[model samples]
Target: MSVKIRLQRHGKKQKPFYWIVAADARSKRDGKYLEKLGTYNPNTNPATIDLNLDQAVQWLHNGAQPTDTAKAILSYKGALLKHHLDGGVRKGALTQEQADAKLAKWLEEKAGKVDTKKEGLSKAQEVAKAKALKAEKEANDKRAAAAVEAAKVEEEVAVEETPEVAAEETPEVVAEVAVEETPEVALEETVAEVAPEETPAAEETSEETEA
Candidate 1:
């Protein structure tokens, strides 16, 4: 019975999650498995993995052939490296203690790199959010200033229109003044006629006296 180490697909569409399994080679892709290794979640930033390193190495040592993608996953998580080191221990080329120390150091370095990437991503998001907020605030302030300027312009237009409206209304007032002075003009004409009559009467009286 040939056993294979592979990933079984799960999770929703587009967002894929997988289970690492040791299963019979003849079984369907989603069928029964011999042993469950762990899980792999690629939706995360660094691609979260929860692998049992000892179990993976054991399966590899037992000749369970891994699929191409699973091989890469195992290689990335240090399972392949541990298996190789164990091989060296079996061949008397290196001690178990030396292999353990090297694996430990490599894992520590990988973890540090993951942490650095996470911190950089977080800082970049914060900067972008702050910049967007500043831009929005500036837009709002510009709109408010434009509205105030428009109001001032409208007020000035109303002030300019007031005098024009009053000028239009003044012609009737001038006509009324002209009509009120007509009676005084008529009285002056009557006085002029009486003066002429008095002049003629004076001339007649002088002649009678002389006679």
Candidate 2:
């Protein structure tokens, strides 16, 4: 039976995880496998993968056909590269020691690149957080300033209304003073008229007595 290298689905819905496996070509996608290779988790920032490089190279040597995704995974983890190096060793084109050295150097460089990517992501997150905080502070400041302005407007309105109330009461005070002065003027006029009538009556009495 022909063998195939493929991924077997696992993990929860919507967050798919997988296991790399070498299995009979006729088996169901997630069924029995000849060997468990490694795991692939796509839920991480830079999709995490763990592979048994030696075992994977051995499978490739034995002519296991890998699916496209499986081939990419093997390539990423350097299994394909190791397989090629082993082929060159078998052909006497490269020594085993040389192959191992090259693979190790490549793996080291790949690790450094991954680390640099992680650092860039971390710095980007910090910048985003700082920007969000600054925006929130600015929004709060605007609200505080608006509240102060509203309070000042209310105070000015109250002050303006105070003068209008005082002006309304001024007419009543003037009316009271006018009423008090009118009564005094009327009494003086009445006293002057009565004195004139009494003087006229005394003159008539004197004339009659003289006659």
Q: Global lDDT of each model?
A: 0.95, 0.96
Roughly what TM-score does model 2 have, to 2 decimal places?
A: 0.75
- Report the C-alpha lDDT of model 1 over 63-113, residue by residue, as the tens digit: 999999899999989999999999999999999999999999999998898
The all-Cα superposition gives candidate 1 an RMSD in Å to the true structure of 7.0
Could you tell me which 10 consecutive residues in candidate 1 have the lowest summed lDDT?
169-178
Clashes of each: 0, 0
| Candidate 2 lDDT by residue in tens digits, 61-170 | 99999999999999999999999999999999999999999999999999999999989989999999999999999999999999999999999999999999899999
Which parts of model 2 are misplaced by more than 4 Å? 165-211
Error of 1 at 115 (Å): 1.1
The local lDDT score (0 to 100) that residue 59 gets in candidate 2 is: 95
RMSD to native for every prediction?
7.0, 5.6
Provide the TM-score for each candidate, comma-separated: 0.74, 0.75
